[model samples]
Target: MLQCGVAIAAMLTVAPSMALASADSAMLPRNLSPWGMFTHADVVVQTVMIGLALASLATWTVWLAKTVELRQATAQARERMAALEGGASLAELARDCGEASDAVARLVQAAAHEASLPGASWDSDFKERIALRLERVEAAMARRVGQGTGILATVGAVAPFVGLFGTVWGIMNAFIGISQAHTTNLAVVAPGIAEALLATALGLVAAIPAVVIYNHLARVITGYRALLGDASAQLLLLLSRSKGRPAVAFGRAG
Candidate 1:
């Protein structure tokens, strides 16, 4: 009789907890995919994930546009540089540029404009002023070419932290679920954790490519700037050679 009473008491004490654990376990999903996990995530976590995905898309988009722009600019600059070095006159070169807004074209036009000014004699002061104009044009062109890349940098730097915030929010919800369910079973805890980790994975997916793209574009831009520098040097060379001749004489020869 005493043993029977003890057994009954133990069963009464443990039954509720076991039932709670079973209920919590039943509530967990068996198969989880990225889409399913996202759908099942807390609103905040979902938002973070969506934002990261959009950022990743934007990174690639910028990479595509900027890559094309840089390639065309570099090619045009090389062409103009070749022509400039081959003793093409400013009027001829400007005609070749022909209102096309490539960086090299802009540099040539700016230099040509400075050269065309009335009474713009070829002296130290004249060269200094032309040099200043070329510098401004180069700086402006660099800034224009680099416009959309800053967003990629920001995305690369901040995405992981945004994912971490999502993960933290998810884990907090998991703990809250544990409290409500009154259970600590692996089945109940694992699903929430997996979902939370997916956020971090998404973040890395978004960030790593952004960082790589940003670096690649930076290098390409640097190379493009070097090409511009070469073009500028070629222009200065032509100016030096024309020191004693009439500017019209140089323009007429080419």
Candidate 2:
């Protein structure tokens, strides 16, 4: 009888430990990974996360394409300006530079075309017209070069809010779980809170780089526009020198 009583006591002790161990195993996550969190996240949160990721990709793509285009354009403008540094006639420069979309080349061609027209004059009025045309070209080139940058601004402005929405949704879902489970245990709450904060972290990850990239590209584009203005000034100086001279043939073969 005494041995049977001792066995009952041991069984009671072992039973509680086994029950606690089972509870702990159930509380712990099977895989505490980002991909796992994503898979287990609410549908709305998942959608927001996906959208923010795509926006990040768009920011990088625009940065790459615009960087290449702006660098090439800035270099070409400098080269054209250097070619004009010598006493080369505007007609000679235009022919050698060809009829590409080069800012300096186009400016020269426009001036030459105006000069070739019947009744064309090189007076204060004529010079004003040329200056106006140059300004229009500058504006157009600026617009063209700045295309696709607006998306960066949009991403920078919206990504954080999108992430915040996801976080709010996640926390709300966590509270719902708490209410359903009828418990305030740390194990029950920590997972949901961590997941909610993860949304905010992802948001910062997406937004900070987008804002930085947009500002950097803005500065680079501004510099490129300044180069275009310098090219316009150089062309105007060439025209000023040739104002009273005989008409020069442009695009003539050497």
In model 2, where do residues sit more than 4 Å from their true spots? Answer: 1-28, 249-254
lDDT of 2 by residue, 57-127 (tens): 88889889989998898898888889777767777776776667867677767766666666666766777
As a whole number from 0 to 100, the lDDT of residue 234 in candidate 1 is: 82
Listed in order, each prediction's TM-score against the native is 0.89, 0.87
RMSD of each: 3.4, 3.5
Question: Local error of candidate 2 at 4, Å?
Answer: 11
Top candidate (lDDT): 1
In model 1, where do residues sit more than 4 Å from their true spots?
Answer: 1-18, 249-254
